[model samples]
Target: MFKLIAFDLDGTLTQHRSKLDQTNRKVLEELDKKYKLLMVGAGGCERIYNQLNCFPIDIIGYYGMQESVMNNGQLKIVRSDFYTVDKQYFIDATDKIREKFGYTDYAGDNVDFHETGAVTIPLLGKSAPIEEKVAFDPDRKKRAVMYPFVKSLFDGFNVFIGGSSSFDIVKERFNKYNALTAYMKEHGINENEVMYVGDDFGCGGNDEQIKTGGLNYTLIDDYRNLGNKLAFLL
Candidate 1:
């Protein structure tokens, strides 16, 4: 029996960049009774908390770089970590990478310099209109073509195909595996007791680490079916 149920927020719980609906909310309410509910998100804890309409649940954000819990009847960040990047190095490296990949011409900012050092080389830049970003990689064909090359280029860092238009690079020691492992260690919960649900579990995907961590995992392909898919688990 699964004692803990962790979920990926974006694609697994709701449509990408969309809000949780009443049906899923009710499903969550039902699940809450049977297992621990945790939201493991690619974005920040505060954003996740608000996006869920401030639903009551623990959150693992920024791929585990940040953690938060419902505290004082509100979401509170229990831990926060940040890494400083050599901006000059990033600027120089980003330019070179673009040139090598023939991405010299693009829109908006070339590099998304996040406070957490998880660099995003957005093909259409961070400020690109949603339509173009959506059109840029509808099938992830372009990103996949360059995935291996970019992965090798960032040899010392952990790289992943993230969002619809960018690559997420994190520190070597940080990932879903590290995040879940640390979470379990602190909570005294073993792998078998935790069931992880996510969409991005294929190779190079954000949830790959956790899916392959030898933990019980459920793959959620479409948010529309998530309620029915997880009804049995909860």
Candidate 2:
């Protein structure tokens, strides 16, 4: 039996970058009564908290770069960490990758820089239309082929095939695996006593490290069926 259930937001709980629906929200409310629910996200803590409509639950964001907990029905930051990055270095490196992969002609910004020193290499450019971005790589086959190359370029960063058409890059020390383990340690819980539910657990997927890192996890490919996937827990 699991003592805690940690969830990944985007693909696991809802459509990418969308708010949680009333259906899933009700499921979560029911589960919350039986077990602690946590959201582990690739974005910032505040972003995830807000996206959930400020649902009162702890959040580990930016792949563990930040942590926030709900206090008296409100989310409060408990801990956060940011890494310093060489901005020019990323810009130059991304350019080389783009040139090598024929991604030279993009719509807007070549790379997206996050506040936590993380970067996103949006293949179609940051300003690309949403429809095109959605159609860019539905199966992720295209990005998976170049994942190794991108990962190699970002030597000290954790690279993942993120979003619909981009790669998320963060400091190597920050990742879902480390974040979950650290959370377990901090809460005096055993790894086996926790279950991670996420959608991206395949090759180059953001949640891959958690599976490979020897953690108990459940996969939910379609966010619409999240409630059914955790029916046993309910």
Candidate 3:
């Protein structure tokens, strides 16, 4: 019943920031034979394409700020949208949040501003060791506790609990729901003809909007079990 099967890259198809595995890759490959496969990601198009090891698929990135399509076996940037963010404002606001939350002694830069003008306020600082980041919010409780307050501070941006220990703030115009809706409109596909598979569909998660937005969604709890979880689809 699905015409397009969209996937969230990290923690859904593979481990966070990890390459696509052979097992899952083959599943995508097989699924591609029958359905149009797409990647809807929170990161950039190039980053998602590279992480997939150049897997042939169209990608929606930066929560829909950018898009790329596979043509002639090469990934081509078909659309790149940019938003100008007040960097100093973000830094100042982050500082305020940090102080209020007793996170004044971070390891490095507090705000990570992306090319798309999206911001990631890494609680542990950007340069902190990966081990520390993984340990800091393995269950995301610490950040989730501060989600409402932090989101309130950024009035116009959509805030989400991101990565292992950070919050992603994007323009109010974008989110996974907007991204997928745009995709469906562009492709002339109905909502019922699409399916979204993602891991982070809970509260404060990046995929939460789409999961609860009246669409057909499949939740993935573990990346390693993705193939089994979607076996019926194959």
Candidate 4:
């Protein structure tokens, strides 16, 4: 029997960067009766928690680099793994890749440097028009074309086709699989007793690896419909 349920925020539980709805929130409150609820988000744990209006739950953030738990009265970051990278090196490498791949003309910044040293190469550039960001790589063909090359260049790092038009680079062994596995170990729970629910489970999608890694997963396509889809589980 499933003892724990981990949720992916966007497109599964809520709209992208949206607050939880009453319907789903009520579903969760009910599910809390039999299962330990958790969130596995691509963004930071604090950000995810805040977006949910600070609903009480454990969060796995930044793929797996961070994890926050609800303490007695406040949220506590039980884990914060930071890996550094050479900024100039990343800038130069991205520049070369852009030119070589014919993405020579971009609107905003090419590389998004994260505080934790993780990087996002938004193929459409950082400040691209919203319409263009939505249109540029819907099929993911553009990014997938260069994913292998970029992965090769950034050896030892885990790369994911994240968001609408970017690649997320994190330290190796820092993906959701690692985070969930680590969380399970820390809580003295069995991986087999947990089920992960997410929408992005396709090629290069952040959730793809975990699904492919032999984890029990429920694929969600739309957030609004998630309640009825998972109502039986509750």
lDDT of 2: 0.89
Per-residue error (Å), model 1, residue 14 = 2.0
Cα RMSD for candidates in order? 1.8, 1.4, 1.3, 2.2
lDDT of 2 at 174: 84
TM-score comparison, 2 vs 3, better candidate:
3
Best by TM-score: 3
Model 4 spans > 4 angstroms off? 129-135
Which rank order by lDDT, best down to worst? 3, 2, 4, 1
Which wins on TM-score, candidate 3 or candidate 4? 3
Clashes of each: 0, 0, 0, 0
Give the 10-residue window scoring lowest on summed lDDT in candidate 3. Answer: 131-140
For model 3, the superposed segments whose C-alpha errors exceed 4 Å read none
What tens-digit string does per-residue lDDT give for candidate 2 at 1-234?
A: 788999999878887778899999988899899888899889888989888988899999989988999898888988878777888988998898898889998999988988778888899999998778878887789999999898998887889999889999998888899999999999989987999999989988999999999999999978899889999888
Give every collision pair in model 3. Answer: none
Per-residue lDDT of 138-162 in model 1, one digit per residue for the tens? 4567877888878887767888878
> What are the runs in model 1 whose C-alpha is more than 4 Å off?
none
Taking all chains together, the TM-score of candidate 4 against the true structure is 0.88
TM-score rank order: 3, 2, 1, 4
Per-residue alpha-carbon lDDT of model 3 for 1-234, expressed as tens digits? 889999999889987777899988998998999999999999999999988988999999999999999889988999989989989999999999999999888887889989889899989898988778877876678988999899898988999888887899999888999999999998999999998999888788999999778888898988889888888787
Question: Which model is ahead, 1 or 2, in terms of TM-score?
Answer: 2
Give the Cα lDDT of each candidate.
0.82, 0.89, 0.90, 0.83
Model 2 — which ten-residue stretch has the worst lDDT?
A: 78-87
